[model samples]
Target: MVAKSAKLTQLIQAVDGQKVHQIRCGDHRFIDVTIVQTQGRFFVRQYKFSKRSWYDAFINNPTIDGLPNGAMKIGDLEVQINGKVPEDLQSMTPSVNQAYRKLLGLVYPLMRLTFDRQKHEATTLELIPVFDH
Candidate 1:
């Protein structure tokens, strides 16, 4: 199992306590991420802000660098994107879809006017915590 940093542990606790909605990286970047823990394992979901899908980029090049270091690196962490896709594909819940809509609405009001459900499902990148073997 990969080790979880003290800072990350604290941040997770705070998030679970409903204290924060975003995570800060070592590069001093704040990303809106949803922390998920199941069966005693931790995971993170990162939203893609670019108009173009990162699916191709991630698939073509899995090794990633410049990961934000909030709890963990705070400025020195290189990560790999294990998997990425729209969250709706993972959880077919109306609420999740609605939440994505609301999030998009906040950024691009024009998106709220029309609904191309399949085309613009919120792009979510799923990161699994792992320790080097």
Candidate 2:
């Protein structure tokens, strides 16, 4: 018989081992593969159940140059892995911000998977922008 626990170990384990990597795209662009911060690192790793792991990927750093113009991508998706949340997001490199906003859209499903904020608070301190991708 299964254990008398409401929690399954697989889900718990999956939520404990997510990962990401980074790489440089040509001269100015830096690429990344990041797990959402709210998910607790390694808790919801990308690729879910793919062959390669984060250790097998490139871990790029935050780019600030014209890198966004040439941001890295996998398949049809551009990686908008911002290493830091800038204090003034608008003052950010337009391209990177654009890239990030593009990425922000994709995170909706992932974000919904974890937490649902109170509508009011969620709307109030919103700083992240959206892109038309």
Candidate 3:
């Protein structure tokens, strides 16, 4: 659900470094990701899913860059994901899985049956707060 009172910046701050956020875009299903504060800016890591990556789904559309207005949540609290797999993805998966184990455990098992790690790409989604319409 889209938050009516919470600004994107506030929401980012609320979850940054402390918790994981699940974000859903357009008609896509929700995925648990994090809001990382890096190099004095914020970014969301999007992993490539089996068939398509977040970058693949939204890159062609210019509307996503602006991310206008509100952000989405699942049942009150959650976040977003993005991008293609990185070159070092194999190395990264172990830690990524551990950090998000509580969340991933529920979905990873079923996903492992059909999900091939090599099929996806890792990319970053820079979160720029769009305050006004």
Candidate 4:
């Protein structure tokens, strides 16, 4: 719906027809992204610009090349996790309760994005996408 990044707009247009599509995270889950076509459709992963770890070992190590895979396949859409709270809520500290709630709110779109990975077009969050919708 809303195009925040010109790169993303170009990606969607890059493979404007056919069926299956995918994008690669070259730098990390945040920095580099390249769109690829499978049969025809488009796919996008979650990435952020700030998450790139400029460390040597994680970057130079051959085994640790080209971003961690956080793009979960649901159907058509990929749930690109730019960041996530690795620990379960039950195990969270009491002081982080506010943070936990905020996280849930942030991840709600991601949860819906799950359906997109599955190629389910009926994806909707409480019957809404944008707040102004």
Best by TM-score: 3
Model 2 lDDT on a 0 to 1 scale:
0.31
lDDT of 1 by residue, 1-133 (tens): 4356753464345434441244333334444454443322334333444543233344344434533212321223433224434344556334444444433446435643565544444444444333331
Model 2 Cα lDDT, one tens digit per residue, 1-133 = 4342322343223322332333333344443554222211111123332454232232233335423312323333333322233344344334332333344667645654664333311211111111221
CA deviation > 4 Å runs, candidate 3 = 1-9, 64-122
Across residues 1-133, which tens digit of lDDT does each residue of candidate 3 receive?
4563465555545655355665554566766666444333344555544457545555443354644322445346443323323345556545545444433456656665665544422454544344443
Greater lDDT among 2 and 3 belongs to 3
Winner on TM-score (1 vs 2):
1
Ranking by TM-score: 3, 1, 2, 4
Candidate 2 regions exceeding 4 Å error are: 1-18, 23-35, 39-76, 80-85, 88-130
- Could you say which candidate leads in lDDT? 3
How far is 71's C-alpha from truth in model 2 (Å)?
3.8
Answer with 1 or 4, whichever has the higher TM-score.
Answer: 1
Model 4 residue 7 lDDT?
A: 37
RMSD in order of candidates: 7.6, 17.5, 7.4, 15.8
lDDT of each: 0.40, 0.31, 0.48, 0.30
